[model samples]
Target chain A: MTLLAGHPTKVGRLAFVDQDYPIVLPVNFRVHRGSVVFRSDTGSKYMAAAMGQKVAFEVDDVDEAWQEGWSVLIQGMCHEITDPHQLKLIDGIGLNAWAGANMHTLEILHHRITGRRIV
Target chain B: MTLLAGHPTKVGRLAFVDQDYPIVLPVNFRVHRGSVVFRSDTGSKYMAAAMGQKVAFEVDDVDEAWQEGWSVLIQGMCHEITDPHQLKLIDGIGLNAWAGANMHTLEILHHRITGRRIV
Candidate 1:
């Protein structure tokens, strides 16, 4: 499967560009209508992910017992969402923002999502 | 502290440029000589991280009960290690490669490693 199937944490990462260097951050994200969404604050990661910047999101899981795992890499354009209507949609998903009561939602959309599993 | 003091996993991520779109991948990595190292195969992620590519590596952890967490972002250059002496040193570090005897070690070195913890 091009996407992870039947996995629990659904944890992914966000990567953006800052002064010719790439910055990577681990984020708790969810899949929404073929798009990846997460929560961020006015931090360095959030700042670098200015609207329209090319970015990436990745998710992976490892089964220690089985000694096998799968990884998915998603490359897309970063979009900041401030629409109340859209925010309401993601609010229902219940994100573990870990930020004290003030978090902003961001989304990344791409044409294709790629994944690989070593079984 | 910019680095995780007591987090057990010590896992980080690697981000690289793949034809203009950044690609992020979660990897079980370790910090050595102030550098981030991980095991990779001859895959897309490995291919793109050839020689000296400006990349980023990150690590983060969350305590669900504490409702707080910390994240570290590392930006650096990707260097592939084929030297037997270096490979032997990394092998002694005990990495859970999860690959079938054919994985290669790659290291990303950076001048500065940055992290933030939300309490």
Candidate 2:
């Protein structure tokens, strides 16, 4: 899948099933090659990463008045990045960490990365 | 645990662990009592529901320049609303389904609904 060009300017949203119901959240992300990466501290997202499963990422912009906007969806498998060497590489890229939490632990998940661009 | 007051005009984001990494998505939602609800078609979110697990839901608003906004986070167990009776109740509430897809099946999942409001 193609990463949206020019600094990947899109909001990242994630949807996963929790006990038969769906829970969704929005995140800031940086896309590279074939993986989508973001940072997180000890939380539910961390717990899910510990479980190891496939997940969904959706990004979109909509204007209610115009009834128009574009959305990009990425569906793939993700794996956490734990190797210190890899972590350092991610940090080197200098992505904006806007979550305002200490994500020093740095978990990187990669999705198979298929996307649909809808306008 | 409390639902954000008044029609819950916040963006819903879901974060889940996929194969040792975290994936996040943004969604539209309605909150009532102690649960958060939304609709979906057959997708990854549906698969996660079928697995029966807890998930995370985050809602926030941020104005970059002001560096200020409020975020509400809900972490809990979710169960799909499969019973026809409950399904009808959800439809009756008339929450706006803005996803623009045929969510006629109406799968409702309830989170334990704990939230932190950060401004």
Candidate 3:
């Protein structure tokens, strides 16, 4: 979660299978209670989450010149936060989607989190 | 391809279906003849490529302060460059995996490429 918080871009890629092929999309996200929280319209992402699909969220920082970096991968089942209480709570967390408005909240229930750091 | 070249980190996330779940792993890569090329050992990635699985590779640049960025997504079939001639040609392209030794060459045969930029 600290890595997610400290990412300079505050951006990560959300990976999920769509139409029999894996797809990764860049999303502005926040870490909430050890899970990844982000907003999106009722698009493919929301649909995927609604289906409780397993996903991988990845964030990394690399120094090209030095050839060193650290990466964190979170593998979990995605759930659309539909409960009113949870939705209100997440709204108060101050995570706004980088694009679009009236977005739906989605969370990746972190099942396995791993990190690799190279120096 | 231009975005891949100009990315400061020269890194991107490779997404593929692994064990019924989507997994995304960060990889150091370079563009060669409009395809993303990188090196890897006989790991899950190399195995996935050897199977010719469909994959998604994503790269992005974001400015937290300005709340803007551009993202490129490449949907393709992963292929291990087993042909010695192609391997030699890609080796000459000068992309080294960020870590490890005696890596195998992998390429994503471009099927579809898309990008979005928010200014």
Candidate 4:
């Protein structure tokens, strides 16, 4: 699929699968270059990144009244950023740690990204 | 946390984060030992597993009138089961592939498990 000229302009849901079941979370995001990025603590997302695995990122805008919606799907690799300076940069950019544990302060890392838009 | 005597009896949502946005998917799952397992095809979950990352598996029950809910959170590593024998075994278990693409026939892999229950 050809890349859109800018980040997707709608909010969407993301689903990650383990076994046959899917774990879903809601998110607000932006796409830069060809990669999709988001932030989280030492929770599930962190675990996925640590394993150096490719993940599915999805965004959708659905209108139940009209039963119509558009979605974007992202398939890519996850990377955890451990560099203290980078972590500081992420923190500086207003990515707050809302996770309920002290273990959430780890630095923001970049994810190796690739994906396509499904309209 | 202590292991529960049996699999969790409720359904939950799983979330994976990239950059600062979260990708969420709803799932039905079970806990065996310390791992949570489910099934999906060559879509998002497969991508995450290919990266060998840890993912979050969450299940919840909520009562809108009471505004109460209990959530179970799982953290673990994802491994793709590429063994043809294992693939056949998983396919034999009635795990039907429903993804909208032909690339979804990859075998079911086992996920390394860990998690906690929050009532």
Candidate achieving the largest lDDT: 3
lDDT of 2 by residue, A1-119 (tens): 34443334434665655554445544556665446676654455533643344457776564433434555556555466778887777777655544565454323254445433333
Model with the higher lDDT, candidate 3 or 4 = 3
Cα error of candidate 3 at position A113, Å: 1.4
Model 1: per-residue Cα lDDT at residue A83: 90
Classified by CAPRI criteria, candidate 2 counts as: incorrect
Candidate number achieving the greatest TM-score relative to the actual structure: 3
Supply the global lDDT for candidate 1.
0.69
lDDT of candidate 2 at residue B42, scale 0 to 100:
51
Per-prediction TM-score: 0.83, 0.56, 0.87, 0.37
Count residue pairs with overlapping backbones in model 2.
18
- Which numbered prediction scores highest in DockQ against the true structure? 3
lDDT minimum window of 10 residues, candidate 1 chain A = A1-10
Where model 4 places Cα greater than 4 Å from the true spot, the runs are A1-119, B1-11, B28-34, B43-50, B96-98, B101-119
lDDT of 3: 0.79
Per-residue error for A118 in candidate 1, Å, reads 2.3
Per-residue lDDT over A13-94 for candidate 4, one digit per residue giving the tens place of the 0 to 100 score: 3454545444544333334333444455455554454345445565443332332434445555455556677556555544
**lDDT digits (tens) for residues A52-114 of candidate 1:** 888877777766446677778777788777899989888887666655554677788685687
